[model samples]
Target: MSDASINASTVTTQTRVNEASFGDYFSLLKPRVMSLVVFTALVGLLAAPVPVHPFVGFCAILFIAIGGGASGALNMWWDADIDKVMKRTKGRPIPSGKVEAGEAMALGLALSGLSVIMLGLATNWFAGAFLGFTIFFYVVVYTMWLKRSTPQNIVIGGAAGAFPPVIGWVAATGSMTLEPWLMFALTFMWTPPHFWALALFMRSDYDDAGVPMLTVTHGRRATRWHILVYTALLALLAVGTAFSGIGGPIYLTVAVVMNALFLRGAWQIARRTEDDSEADNYKVERSFFKLSLLYLFLHFGAILAEALLKPYGLGGWS
Candidate 1:
């Protein structure tokens, strides 16, 4: 082959190798996290006292999901460095080289603006503003600032994840109320314990990445204690939410059962020695982490069921 032709072929091959697939861009959104956001936000929207138009509700959720995706993109962009080192995050789009940091940033910014504007046009300015603030909190406050700085990172950063329900409620009602805040409280309180459980099992990832997770900063013993303490508080808040307007027999039942299992899990975790953890392959910690996922989902699912039954005066207790 001629030298020029050989050079052109090499350039084409390199370009093809560097090209990102559609799934690569989607992976930057952290779809797993976005699913939780969508579910909680939907429950909040449904649980509100005022009814919303179906089409408008759909638009609000769509925009909110987009805003969530934007946050994920921005988080990936900012955390690309640490992500590359963490075993858990090394495969993320940016860290794995499937997506560029610059591209993620631009996508984040663009979606951030688009979601906020569309939410406001579809619902209300308040909801739009809340969505915008959520994006900023997750991307700027949590990922950029708190994540690298403190053991309390997840504790404070949890608030950003907790805001979606409140924003959803606002999207439906155009105002704030105690009920939506209760939903926010549920998520906020659940965050520390949920994450601490994972940290117990995955401390190496944070340690290697140099992130100050409680497990790394305070040791596994302290992290276990933190999980127990937070789980107790989360139980209080979860059961209390059962008495709120969004709660009912169904929710109360779910709360009692779930909290019992959750407390048991936390207590078991607290009782475990590091030796025990090693012996059992961190089974207790891993189980608690898995349970935590269901704990939040069932709680919100009960809330949604209550809302669906409210029209028949069968929702909350009389």
Candidate 2:
């Protein structure tokens, strides 16, 4: 190659390297997942017995969202290799070459520190400590360790996602309570089935990435059975929580209706033969996954509505 051609090629490559847009940085934060975190945290904060000042509540959520984003950045930094292999994750900032791995790591650590410190100052040390632990749990326990090592990774590692509501509760009340734990339980039990349903249809992604997802390690039949079992348990927890302090008639109605449909979906998935799945292109699995999204959001939304109705004396049963 000529010297000028080589220089131009190098310049083009360098330009590409330095051309990351705002969306690239935002993508590192995993905005979709962060939205769920923000909504659940807001529900927890609102449901707490103690009321937080509007500005303080806003600050708590902002820092919590930042902490969630930091965890995502760190996860992308570490999982860039596996991400490149997985079709669903190959478009992430690092794997797509839109952002450097080192840049992601630095952004993660910096944001982690800033979010925790600012949360402590804005709310209390208890909430700040929870946020710190949540970030550590997600980045270290789930991403670095369990995710590659075990098929049960989502089951246990789900605790990281489950912590947001508790952190929000503590931020508002400055203490722990059973209500927050109930909310935690709702998310915890829901994770395995939710992810497993995705794994059912996206089995190739996990297999390609060499992640030991239950669908990859245990076969689709076993994964389907596991989904049914967990879905039943999740239904029980969701219904039972309707009697808790956070629950009301609206929540109960949502729980009953959603769980019925969710259980039916689980049953369909559990009974599907391999031939049936292949014939339909795993449509049932895909539908179930979509329903699971609405399942959790509607449940949390009911909780938020109950909170909104509390001051008017219409939250729970009289």
Candidate 3:
């Protein structure tokens, strides 16, 4: 690019440590984000109609989690420049110079192969193949391509995150089915409003990093409206899943309650201006962001409960 840009990137990569700590290496894994991946993947595995041996299930999740972390490291490696510019990510392993980008890349590549192969051996080729594709989609497609180029980056790239539950299901059943896709849809649809809320409050982060978030490309008002629309769509899909094969009284009850609150939050966000947001310090947006974290967990937890209860004729519509 330009000399100025090169200089800025150099400044961003300035070192913080002469030697990386064990924790610095672990930080490359993006453990917090990986936790969500593992949780949802576990829920998917457990919620499948078929059964997995406890040890097999444990191995499957462990591998999937590793695959998730691999994707995280690769993402950090690629985004190190932007990470340094973005306050939310400046402290990450690569950006803060706790670990070299090459080190992160090597770790990511090694883990990618290891996780995929181990997952395949422990579960099935389908699950292994799915994990490999997810890493490729996140690192190659989203991180390298869509993230910097378009506002719709999250809309499409979200499929990578959504795949975990499907992989979990496949690990158990060794094949695909409609039920796991419903879980996929739940996370897919939830991603937008969930992230947009964060964008609402963290607009400056994307702006500073030049990431082309919805808030940056479309403006805050449009982003707010987008959140409302997506939340509405997510609510419909969420509530509708309650009537599907995976849905039962418990899931339905949880869906209705959480979705109602989610929609209300979206509505409150939509009915505001930049002034309104600034005046309240984006309190509603921050609340929505916090709620979004729990939204997926509780839904998956409900699904897990439903699956666990199925043996007693208590789960799903029987």
User: Compared with the true structure, what per-residue lDDT tens digits does model 2 show for residues 1-318?
Assistant: 999999999999987776789999988999999999999999999999999999999999999999999999999999999999999998888888779999999999999999999999999999999999999999999999999999999999999999999999999999997999999999999999999999988859999889999988888899999999999999999999999999989999999999999999999999999899989899999999999999999999999999999999999765
| lDDT tens readout by residue for model 3, 175-213 | 888889999999999998988899889869999899999
* Number of clashing pairs per prediction, in order: 0, 0, 0
- TM-score head-to-head 1 vs 2, winner: 1
lDDT of 3 at 5: 100
Rate residue 113 of model 2 by lDDT.
Answer: 99
Error of 1 at 297 (Å): 0.5
Off by over 4 Å in 3: 1-17
What is candidate 1's CA lDDT for residue 52?
Answer: 95
lDDT of each: 0.93, 0.95, 0.92
What TM-score goes with each of the models? 0.98, 0.96, 0.94
Which residue pairs collide in model 1, if any? Answer: none
lDDT of 1 by residue, 12-75 (tens): 9986877789999998888999999999999989999889999999999889999999999999
Model 3 is weakest, by summed lDDT over 10 consecutive residues, at 10-19
What is the number of residue pairs that collide in model 3?
A: 0
Report how far off residue 150 is in candidate 3 (Å).
0.6
